[model samples]
Target: MTNNQPSPDGILRLINGYWATGIVSASATHSVFTHLENGADTAADVAIRAGISERGAQTLLDGLVSVGLVGLRDGRYRNTAEASAYLVEGTPASLSSFAKLKLTHMNALADLPEVVRTGGPVKQVATEVADNPHWAEVVPAIAAQSVPAATIAADVLRLPEAGAISILDVGGGSGIYSAVWLEANPDARSTQLDWEPINAIARRLLEERGVADRFTCIDGDFHTTDFGTGQYDVALYSHIAHQEGPEGNVEVFTRLRKALKPGGALVVCDYVVDDDRSGPAFPLLFASEMLLKSKQGGTWRRADYHDWLIKAGFEDVSFHSAPPATLVVARQRRRPVL
Candidate 1:
C-alpha cells in the first residue's frame, strides 16, 4: 500500500459509519455518559459503578477515547464536553432518551434488509404493540429530542390577538408546541392528541411546565377522532404528516378544515423534500429511516403540501423563508364574521 495514495472517501465513510453505531450502542448500554457526568473516573471504578468487568469497561472507555467522545486524564476516563452535555441523563440538553429509544429498537436497523425486500416496516411496529409495549415508552423519549423543533412550530402558530385562542396540536408528541404556545399566549390553551402512553408523558411535561391546567390531553387515534368543528383558531400538525401517507395527509387536512374557525391558520412543520425530491440530506435520510421504521411514511414534496392545502379549502399556502425543512402555513378561505 502506497502511503501517499489518495484516500477512498466513499468506502471509508460507509465502513466507519458502522463503527459509530456500535460505539453509540455501547456507551448507551453502559450508561458511560451518566457515569462521567460529575467528573472523571478510572476504568476500574466505572466498571464497579456500572456493574461490568474492569477489563470490559477499560476496552469500552478506550474505544470511546479513540472516537473522541471521551477523554483520558492520568488513567481516568471522562466524557468529552459534547458528550457530557447531551448524553448525561439528567441534563436538560440530554438526548439520552433518544439514544435509549434507538438502543431499545435496534431491531429496526437489524431488520432493514427484510424491510427492503418487503418494502415496509415490519408489521409488528404498528399492529403488534401489545407484544412490544416497550415501544410506548420509547416513542415519547424520541420526541423529547425534537423539542427545539417544536418551539419553532409553536412560534409560527402564534395568533396576534388572543382572547381565548383555541388551539389543536395533532399528533403533538410530548406537548412541546402546546407548552410553548400556552406560555406565550396566556389566554390561549390547547388540546394535545396523541397515543395514550405518549400523551401520558405530555401531560407530565405540561404539568411540569405549569401549563397542564391550560391544556387537555386526548388519548385517541387521531385519524378516527372528531377534532371538533370550528373550535380552534389555530391548528398545528408538527413532524407527523410524513409518517402518514398522502391519503392520510389529505384526510388530516380535511379534518383540520372542519376543526378550525373561519380564517384560522394551520401550521405544519416537517422535513419536506424539494418538489423534485432530489436532495437535502436530513429529510432523505429520515425518509430512509421512515421506510425502515414505518408502514407508509415517506417525505412529501412542498408542492404536494400546497395541493393538499388547496384541496382542504386553504388559501395563501406559503412556505417559511427560514429552515429548508419547510414550514407550510395556510389560512382557511372563509372569512370570520365580524
Candidate 2:
C-alpha cells in the first residue's frame, strides 16, 4: 500500500473503539450526566438519583473520568465541560436523546460475529427495528443529528420569495428542512410525508417553530403515499435516500418528480461518500451502522445521486457537501410529447 496508509496501530484503536462506546452508552442509559447536572456530585448521590448501586455508579463515574467525559475531585464527580454542554438533559446542544436512541437500537448488533457470518442483521429485519416506544427518542435524536445540516442546506437552497412555492418533504422525519424554508419564505407552505408516529414527531417540532399552521402532515410511508401530481414547487428527500439503496431511491425519486409542478425542484440531503467509496470517514462508518439496521442501506456518492436524479426525470442536478452530510439539488424535467 501507499505511504498514505496508517500503521496497524490505527486499526487496533478502531477495533477497541467500542470499549469507550459501550461505557458511554451504559452511563447515558443510566442518566449519569443528568444526575451529576442535578447536584448529584458524589457517586452515592448519583446512585440515589439514577436508582443504581453506589458501587456501580462509582465504577462508571471513574470510567467516564478516564475517558475525560467526567471530572473527579474531592470525592465528588461532575460532568466535563463537553459532557455538561452536550450530554446533560435540557441543554440546547443536548445529545442525551441521540445517545439513548443509538444505544437502544445498537443492542441489535450484540451478536456482531453472527451478523458478519450471515451477511445481514441476524436478529431482526429492518421493519422490526425501532419499535413504537422508541419513536419519541428516534425523532428527537434524528432532529439533533440532522437540523444543523438541514439548516445549512436550507440556506444553500436560496428559495424564492414567490407566494406560489409549495414544498413536499419526502420521509421528512422531523420536518426541520421544510420548517426552515417556511420560516425563510412566509408565503410558502409545506407538506411532510412520513409514518403516523413520525408525523407526530414532526408536528411537535414544527409546532415549536409556530410553522405547524403552514405545514401539513401525511400519515403513511413515502413509498405508498399519494403525492398529488404537479402540486409542489419543491420536494425534499432529506437524509432519506441512503436507507433505501439505489433502486428504491430511483423509484421514490420518480414518484417525487411526478408530484412536482412542471418545473419544480428536488433536494436530497444525505451522507455521501466519494465515488471510490474509499475514505471521508463519516459516511463510511455510517454505512456500517446502516448494515445493522437496513437491508440495502448504505451511503451513496454525489455522482450516483446525480445519475439517479437525471434518470428520475430531473435536470441541472448539482451537489454540495458538508462532511457527514451532502445535498443534491435538481429540477423536474418535463417530458416531451410521445
Candidate 3:
C-alpha cells in the first residue's frame, strides 16, 4: 500500500500485448496494408483486392484500426501513417513482409521457454536459401528498409579522406550499404559476402541500382572462410552483430581487423540497449526475438560494443544514433610495432 498506488497493471498489460504482434502479422500476411497503400477503401474493396473474404477482412482491419496501425473513417479503412510508411508492400520502408516471414517461423516462438533454459540459438539458423526460400524473397524488401542503415554507414565513410577504396560487406544482404556508398562515392568498390541466394539478390539489387559493375559477390560461410587481411578500407557488419553473442562478435571483428588496412573502419548497425538496459522498446523486443532464436545473441549495450572494439584492436570507437538503430564505428588501430 505504498504511495506508488495501484494505478493499473501496466506491465502486465504490456506483457499481454503479444496479441497485437499476432494481429499485425495476420494483417500483413493478408496484405491489408498493401491494399490500403493507395487510399482509404471500404472493407469489401480491401477484401477483393487482397483476395480474402470480406467478413474476415473486416475482422482483421478492425483489429488493425484498434491497434492504431490502420484508420477507419466512414466505414472505409486506410493505413495509419506509421503503417503506410513502414508496412505497405511497395513502400521503401515496408517491413510488413519481413514481419510476415518472421511469423512463418512461429515455431521458433514455441521454443522460447527452452531457449531461456538452455541459452543460445536452439538450432543452427538455416543458412541455406533452399531451406528457406523466404530469405531471398525478403532480401529486397529488407534492403529497401535498410536505406537509413546504408546512409549512416556512408556518412561515417565520408568522415575520412581515403583514396581508392575497397569495402567488404560481411553478411551484407542485397548489398544495401555498398549500393548506397557506391552511389555516393564513384571511386568506391565493394565485395558483398553472404549466402548464395542472398548474394544473388544483392547482385540484382546492385545492378538495378546501377552499381553492379563496381561490386563483387562472395558466397561462403563468413564464420569458416578467410576474409583476407589488409585488403579492405572498410568492413561493414550491419544489422547482424546482435545475432551472435559477445565472444562471437569479438571473433568477427578480430577477423575483420586482420582483413582491414591499418586504418580501416568497421561499421556495425544494430538495435542497442542503453547502458542501463532500462527501456527503448524496439531493441528490447528485438532482444526477445534473440531470446527465442539465438543461443548467444541479444541486443547489447553500447559500452559492451566499445569493450569488444578495443579487444578487437579497434582504436577510435564510438556510437551514433540513426532512426530505429544505432551505428557502432571503430577503426582498426595501426598494427603495433614489435
Candidate 4:
C-alpha cells in the first residue's frame, strides 16, 4: 500500500529560503558579481578583488552556482547570463542594490509572528510621514526592478507613437516611468508627485538620464493632495496599491480618473493576484510584506481592481501581464458630443 503524503522537499526549500537570500546579499555587498565580470575567474582572484577570504569567496561562489547565478567549470567561476545582466554593478538592468535592500528588510520579518498576531505592524516604517527617510534609500534600488515593467507599459500604450503626451506619475518613486516614457517620446513631458526627499532622488536620476528638463515633481501626499482634472494624457500608479486599503485605493483611483484628460489612460502597475487568489506565488507571498508594513494593505485581486476602477468612473478596465508586475489600464470616459 502506498501512503499519500506531500514531500518534505518543498517545505525544506521554503524554510531554507533565507540561505539563498543571505548568499545573494553577501555576494552583492562584496561586489562579487562585479569582480567576476572584471575577469576574476578563480576564488583567490575573487577574494583579493572583493576583499573577502578565499574560503568565503569559494563558498559564496559555490552558493551562487547552486542558485544558477554563477557558472563553474574547470576550477573557474563566471557570472551566468542572468547574473551578468542583472547582478553586476553599473549594468543598466542591475538589481544589486535591490538585493542589498532586501537584506535589510529580512530583519523586519523576524517580527512576522507578532505582526500577524496583532494584525498590523508593531512599528510602521512604510508610511509617508514627512520625516521618513526610507524612500530615499528604497526608491533608486527599486527603480531597476521597475525598468522592464515600465518599458512594457510604454510599449503597450505606444507612447512613442502618441506624440507630445503629458504624464502624471502619482507617487512615482524614482521617476523611472517618466524617464522611460520621456526617452521613448522626445516631445513628451512628465510630472512626478512624491515626497520631497524622493523627488530629490528622482530629479537627480532624471537629470543623469538627461530628461530632468521634461520632468517635474510635486511634493505632497497623494491622500490629501489634489490631482488636477484634465491635466494628463497618461497617469501611472505603480507599486503603490498594495500599501493601501480598499477605501484608500478607490479614493486614489477616483482622483486619478479625474486627473486624466478625456480618452487618457490610467496605468496601474502592481503585484496583482488572480481573482480567486489561488496562485501566481509571488503576489501571494508579497501580501505578508504588506501585512507587516501597513495597517490595511494586501495583494489585491483582479476582481477588486475591476470594482474599484469602475466605481472610480473609469471605463474599459483591462489587465496586462508584465512579469514581476501586472498592468491595469483604464480609460477616462470621453464626454459625449452635445
What is the model-wide C-alpha lDDT for candidate 3? 0.81
The runs of at least 3 residues in candidate 3 whose Cα sits more than 4 Å from the true structure, single-residue gaps closed, are 1-18, 73-76, 121-124, 127-134, 137-141, 159-164, 332-338
**Which one wins by TM-score: 3 or 4?**
4
TM-score, structure 4 vs. true: 0.95
- Residues 61-147 of candidate 2 have per-residue lDDT tens digits of 978987799988888888989898778877645777787666556566576677666666765564444346666667777676665
Task: Encode model 1's per-residue lDDT on 171-234: one tens digit a residue.
Answer: 8877877877788777888998877877887888888889899999888878888999999888
How many clashing residue pairs, candidate 2? 0
- Candidate numbers sorted by TM-score from highest down: 4, 3, 1, 2
User: Candidate order by lDDT, highest to lowest?
Assistant: 4, 3, 2, 1
Q: Can you write out model 4's per-residue Cα lDDT over 1-338, one digit (the tens) per residue?
A: 24977778778878999989999999999999999999999999999999899999999998999889999899989999999989999977799999998988888989999999999999955664755778778888989988888889988999999999899999998888898899999999999998888889999999999989999999998888999998999999999999999999999999998888999999999999998899679999999999898888999999999999999999799899997689999996677999
Candidate 3, residues 1-338: lDDT per residue as tens digits? 47968756677667767667777888888878888886538878878888989898888887788789888777777777888788887665678777776666666777778777777557766543334876766677567667877776677668334557999999998788888888888888999888887888889888888989999988887888789979998888988887787888999999998999888888888999999998577998789777765556789998999999899888899888886788888996676789
lDDT of 4 at 87: 93
Best by lDDT: 4
* Whole-model Cα lDDT of every candidate shown, in order: 0.77, 0.79, 0.81, 0.91
